[model samples]
Target chain A: MDLRVEFAGLVLKNPIITASGTFGFGLEFSSFGDLKRLGGIVVKGLSLKPREGNAMPRIVETPCGMLNAIGIQNPGVEAFLKDKLPLLPWRETAIIANLYACSVEEFGDLAGVLSGEEGVAALEVNVSCPNVTHGGAAFGQDPAQITKATEAVKKRCGNKPVIVKLSPNVTDIAVCARAAEAGGADALSLINTLLGMAVDIKTRKPVLANVVGGLSGPAIKPVALRCVYQACRAVGIPVVGIGGIASAEDALEFITVGATAVEVGTANFLRPDQSFRIIDDLPRAMLKARAADMAELRGSLVLPGQ
Target chain B: MVVRNCREVKVQSVRFLGTWDEASDFVELTLENPGWESYRPGQFAMLRPKHWGLELPWGRPFSISRLDAETLTVFFQVIGRGTSRLARLNPGDEVVVWGPLGNGFSAPPETPTLLLAGGMGIAPFRGYIENHPTPEFLRLFFAHRVPLANYPYLAMAEKVRAEAMQEHTPEDLPRIIERIRELMDENHGGIALACGPTPFMRTIQEHAVAGGLRAELSLEKSMACGVGACLGCVCKNGEGKHVQVCARGPVFQADAVQL
Candidate 1:
């Protein structure tokens, strides 16, 4: 009853991969569990130039969730390619690097650099950073911007598979998902951290230095499930369901909703070995759900008419 | 990560051992863990209020206040969010505890020691004096407003008794050196160890040099990776050499660290 999954053309051993922002370049967790044991390790978002990120207080804990406005701090694409890439000891897992940009050209430039990298299995093009303050956060909110951003990345990526990460801040996520597919996205990952805030009541100010941040936790589970349900139906490519997937029962929910693969974010910070815990729980969840195999549960989200 | 269960924890009761005004919410918790019989100076522990949701790691670092080899005590000022949350908890509550990490103070047993403390910098000195009791040799305990006469608990033993040495801010380096020279003139040679803020440490080191006293100064700085990977807590020493406060020395030789 164990769930097996494939993302784009890459076959993952399991469906539980740690999400990007939460997992710091995949090396830190090597102490508790073997890196090759789980599915994949999504590296943090990279850009054409290095970034110091937002000021201090980048993260704060709200009721049942966390708001992080880290602003995608990374050591640029050239440095990542030179310094971080060669250090990865990938045996049974895939290394998916997430790319971000303030403009289409920067996104395209990042994709171009990753496309030639030998160890990278795929590219997760990030169109949804919230802390940018200006037009930078616009790409993932509108369908047109999503399509334009995805197309720009796809054009430069050549044969590289692009997974367009969509934000939940939008009104309707399906429209945004369709645009990503139309612009040549190979796959999709849903519900980047939901935007939320925690205020210091006494101080009459926000807890995080950044006034608001992307929220991720068990608190955002229902919204994330709904987003994954919508995006899976809107696009033909694989949907890697993310957001609030901590336990095996949580992973099974995304699998039943038509997610070919799933990512464990925020939970990674809480428990570095959460990928293994979720992966360990999946087989028993499948047995309890009485599912035959991963194929049958892949698209169990059929409509009434269908 | 290796699970070492707590044996007999002494002093189950916690008392607010300092000025408890709401404006400055600092608490010195006396956890009654008789089993906590072993702890080194300069080491810290992370404890959370009992049943606090695991939203954040229950473990936040706190400097040890007093160690009786049976009962472990710690002192912390409520500064930001975590400590504020901790201030709300009461006695008879159990916070998840993970502890005794990183290198502690090198409090070599009383081979003639000179102890210098500033403000709350006196926290770790309690343990050092208890462990290394040297009365015959001269020792100096520098306090802001004569904390010894106020606290009175430290100088109770002859093996560790020391005279109060007061040095006002920035201007009285010469007077401070004269006091140190008078002490060294009498006893076996001792190492000068001071713990205070950056500016306070600089003055102590300067005065120690004028008196020709070999000194070591402990520092307090903002830190993220206390174990030395993040490079977040780097401070430049006199030689322009950068040192990690968490890993290298919360305690540094006065002459070694320019500040």
Candidate 2:
């Protein structure tokens, strides 16, 4: 029944955090469920300057999932701090800032500004956003770039924990995970949507204006779990699992495989109150697994030979 | 009981209300009155077909064409996989719907109201005229390639006193504008509301702006969450702020949007 989890040194009421980009600044969801009930909320991806995002048909539904190329359309960091940050009920739950930029310095600068802000509990550096033309591919694809971005943020982020959200497009996720850990990341969250595209045959054109997008939903759960398993083994830091988590049982799969926390993304689109439903049902799931708390369930996966 | 404002719901009585062609369809659903909010004209709902599993993961937003105490009706063009699957729904099947959402039309009282709908844009006008204090004060102008008989709500439009005109080509838009101009001149103090494709609404907005006539518009966008959280259904207003159509609108003053 005690679902509390200590993720990256932040004690969450539960491990169910609304993933970035999917849950805009958080106030929008307050009407559906009690924000106070959520473990945390990773607000929409933010940057130093506001982004206009992509063109029309930014999203397209695929098999058991969706592809989106929203390109992180956010009001610049200053506007967010001045106009939007004040709107959140900081006392109710953790607020993790999902920061994206075209360069390492931009990431550091944004992290510094957010570090001084009163309510932010952590900073989620987004190096894996597949929708952008610049930083997404530049920083997330190379282990060296991952180390630089994570170290830059850690240096400027004051005492707040820094979580590097890893992209699933890489050839080896463990290499990136180790690099982030070496750079002093308090934790890691995987996997940020996989790169994919869908084409409309009638017009002979891709469904999204950007032509390609990051795939998310139940379709990517197997890929996500595999990545999480690898990343957890590659580093000493905690890993937050995300991808197709729609139920308590699904969340348990990640926790058992060594994810210290889990964030719900596309499922929020299907049902805004899904996290609340998952949280409420975790007790029965725990009973079924015969685990009292998330701690007992974390990293409990057994290997075939060992 | 109606689960008003509770975005997650399951409702039965999924009856296909028949269609004009394979491309257009109507699905009527009934929900208990408790837990749901009574909807206003111009508001919309999000519908999702159950049991399709991952093939259909999200809901599509539709204008609430009609609303009774226990039933809500929506009309959709079977354009994609979700709607195509919805087109096959049979009576007694259950579907998930949530809403009565977004800011709906605000019709000024006792004033003549002109409704300009392009193609399937006629969806919300039914709720407006039926629930109006003076239904006789409503007038409509619909433009679509299909004949009046094929228009989804032709019978309902007739009951509400709609005036129909045939547009043989896109070139007829200019002639249609001329007609709207004449109507505007005749009803000096009337309010105009328009909906349809972006290009269609843009044309109406330009005319309304040029003539200094009061107009409101309903916009359409690709929305993942029919709530504000997804930030996907954004529309730029006169101020350059990206507002969510599902939250701030789906309906906005004609002057309030960039069109």
Candidate 3:
């Protein structure tokens, strides 16, 4: 069966893409499996300057999911372009850079810096990181800021497709999706992570040093699907679903809810070669679902009344 | 300059041999080796049973306690939900393991090395003691709350000059600390390697630095991914910069990290 998918002016060999932050710079996992087998890789979030991130104990496992407050610790955009990008097999696969900045101007500047790079296929704007202290989920939670940030990146991004990654902590994900569309976002990816926290009953201390973190994994899959479905209906642009997607069946669930593609996030931690395995299993998953291709199954959800 | 060895790491499915109770709470697990490249002494691996579902999503990181021609051994105490589940595995059960990860202990072969460990901290020394070129020159001082019979002390003691101390109460800490200081004083100009609880490690680190002695420490942190991608297992360095423990080290120089 054909597994190719074209969305937001980019063609993926398959609908399987590794989410940002989880996949590192794409080189760390190269030893686990062939990097060329993946349809796309969204590298860790980059900023204008290197970030030290939060204190120790930045993650906590809760039930089937995990919460992280990494605070988008990266080596800055320049270091990535000079040191990391040259080593990736960008010629065969899409290398999307995830951007993190403290302000609209910085976001635009970061977009300008990466958009000119030949190896970077696209720019993923990270307005939904719940771990940082400022200018993260704040921009994603406010419709006006989301529109402004998307517009800022779009204006300076040149020909590179700008994907606004939205937050699930917001009240109405459709409103945020429409806001990005209003600012001319080529596509949208949701949801970044839900805000949550854990506590140690014995020490009476917060589990994470940052106290609150973004929740991801199988626990957040239903919430992610709900956000993606609402956002897909509200906007004309393609939506890439992310959040706790572990298996090909999970990827198909997002596709069935109107997502053009799905990004494997937290599962990459559970198993480094998870994305590659998902890609290999997609054709079999499609056959089991009795579909000719992704298009045949895209948004095929049935309503009870209908 | 200290040269660290880098090896190719891969995920493989191995068969569980069975569990051997080292003590009431501590157990040793043996697995069939699937022809993984040779691993150094202080390195570790992430292990998960194939039957595991979402209840415990990530694998637990364990120090490579011992490695023979055909089998790998990992020792741990029943700590939480993950270990509790791991302790119940049957023989021949399939388990997914990936490793020889993180930088391993690299004490200069010529130097007389003092292996200081506490409780479960003694896990990695079995391989360290057996694999050392000069096993005769190695000395181990293990401190714990339980009896010496509860640990792999005797097995390792046969390979090196091993000694054990029991800390029954907080008041017993100074006596153990005094023993460590005495060991450091006697082994002056030599190197010390340590692993254990934070305070125990901190005590060793403090004395090592104050005495101007070279020391290496193996740190433990709650890690989601044993790889560096998640950035979850980071600790501040001596320079106060955060470095990934899983990538930079689960083992670091005494002066390299804050504690």
Using DockQ as the measure, which candidate wins? 2
TM-score pick, better of 1 and 3: 3
- Per lDDT, what order, best first? 3, 2, 1
After superposing candidate 2, which stretches have Cα over 4 Å from the reference?
A129-137, B1-4, B7-19, B22-34, B90-92, B147-155, B166-177, B239-241
Which scores greater on DockQ, model 1 or model 3? 3
User: What is the overall TM-score of model 2 with all chains considered together?
Assistant: 0.92
TM-score of each: 0.70, 0.92, 0.94
Candidate 1 fnat reads 0.05
**Residue B189 displacement in candidate 2 (angstroms):** 2.7
Error of 3 at A290 (Å): 1.0
Q: What share of the true interface contacts does each candidate keep?
A: 0.05, 0.57, 0.54
Question: Chain B TM-score of model 2, please?
Answer: 0.88
Q: Which lDDT tens digits does candidate 3 get at residues B2-86?
A: 1222222222222222233543467687777645657788888888777888768888899999887777788888778888887
- Give the number of the best model, judged by TM-score: 3
lDDT of 1 by residue, A1-306 (tens): 445676678878888888886666776455546778778888878888887666556666655666777777677888877887778765468889899887777788888887877788888988885435445556788787778889888888867788999998999999999999999999999889888888878999987677888888777889999999988888889999998876788888888999988898876544445577677778888888778777788878667898
